[model samples]
Target: MNITFFIKEFHLRHPVIKEIKSALIKRGVNLDFVVLKETILDLQSLGHLKFASNSDLVVFKTTKYFAEHLAILMEDEGLRVINGSKSIRLNRDKILNNITLRKSGIKTPKTITFHSSEIKKISQKMFPMVIKPVVGGRARDVKLVSNKSELEKNEKNDDIVIGQKYIENDGLDRKLYVVDDKVFGIFKPSVLTPSDNSNAFKEFKVEEDLKEIALKCGEITNSKIYGVDVVLGEDGPYVIETNDFPGFRGIKNAGKIIADFLYFKKNEKR
Candidate 1:
């Protein structure tokens, strides 16, 4: 069977991807990769790409606009894409992801999304909130603001942002990685805290409630392989974010699990 990975060039060197690639190669599966940065998507001629046309399964790894558009086009041609374009688009927008989770009765922190121009109009009561880009990953530019001055000073007045009420938790973040029906938890230092060993990740037991929430997020977003960030708040656990095609850095044997899932999925009847 043929399998194609649509990813950024940097992802080719990721340990997890490397391991998965090695395993797939050992199994003698035909594999191809399209580096998004180097490839051009010709909208006028959709199905002409040899990689997409010959693949039995396409792993939609990158969330870039071009990759998403191509994935949508591939789906239009009846090719199966993991985590689908809709799921990637939904997870890309922090505001939309929060709204969708809340509408689905999922417990999430109180969030307010507004344009940067309206920053001064925000209420002071919302101080001590976490301000982050509406569409971002890896917690880049995420900040904790205690007042309007800090909020205005920390965030640029040119893009959309979301101010989420900070949920007090022990300085550890519960990162739950979901692979199909299975879920694995990893404990790591919170992004707000300064940790010399930020890369340190340890395995943790996945509680039933957390597992349920993780699975529900998958169902809500229509994602099979994803990650859910949760923090233990005063009222149990609250989901912080859901990431599509997350890097499963902490899970043991993650490459094998993911490869097995892909092989089974590729061979299964649609």
Candidate 2:
């Protein structure tokens, strides 16, 4: 089968990307990859790629816009998409994901969604809260605000934001990657200090319960692959968020897992 790997032009040199490309080539799959850069002309390139599409599967590693656009074209051509438009769109937004998790009876952090105008109202409900953009991943636009003054001082973006009480922890964060209703891998993020927040990921491992939650989360999201971040809180293990098509920045063995899924017998279905 012909495969079109859509990776960000800036991230083409990442080790995981190289490894997957190489493994797919060895599998005798006709792999064609295009480095899609972030630019004003991105839409044009996306259109060209869609129009020129000939692959049986399209593996995207970038924004939802590209995935959604390509998914539409691919659907017209009857091609299968790994992280399809529906899955990507549903899991990317924190608000939508929370709704799904709640409906699925899965345990996630207690969250309060509010308009920018309701920021003060949110402050009254929770303290030592974590505020984040609804349509975000990998801790982007996530802030830990301790009080109302801080929340009000921060400039709000266009995206809807959610505020949730921060659960005090033993200071370890777990990232669990789930694929096809199974726990693919779990890593403990590496951190230099408890307060250090420059880099988003601290590279941690597969605690059995975290693995289970990861699997359940994958099933809930209905995505072939996604990352579930969880924290050990006062109540229990609470899911921090679900990320669709998340990056494997500092995780060990993640590249191999992704490669195996892409080129191995298990991924033969789609």
**TM-scores of the candidates in the order shown:** 0.94, 0.82
Tens-digit per-residue lDDT, 81-104, candidate 2: 777666676776778888888788
Candidate 1 whole-model C-alpha lDDT, 0 to 1:
0.86
Kindly report which residue stretches of model 2 are placed more than 4 angstroms away from their true locations once superposed.
38-52, 156-159, 181-205, 265-270
Tell me the TM-score of model 2.
0.82
> Which residue ranges in model 1 land beyond 4 Å of their true spot?
38-40, 47-50, 195-200
> Relative to the unseen true structure, what is the Cα RMSD of model 2?
3.8
Tens digits of lDDT, candidate 1, 15-116: 889988988888889999877784565766664355678788999787875766777778998998997888888788888899999999999988998876
Clashing pairs in 2: 187-204, 188-203, 188-204, 188-205, 189-202, 189-203, 189-204, 190-202, 190-203
Question: All models: lDDT?
Answer: 0.86, 0.68
Q: In angstroms, what RMSD does candidate 1 have relative to the true structure?
A: 1.9
The best candidate by lDDT is 1
Q: After the best TM-score superposition of candidate 1, give how far the Cα of residue 164 lies from its true spot, in angstroms.
A: 0.4
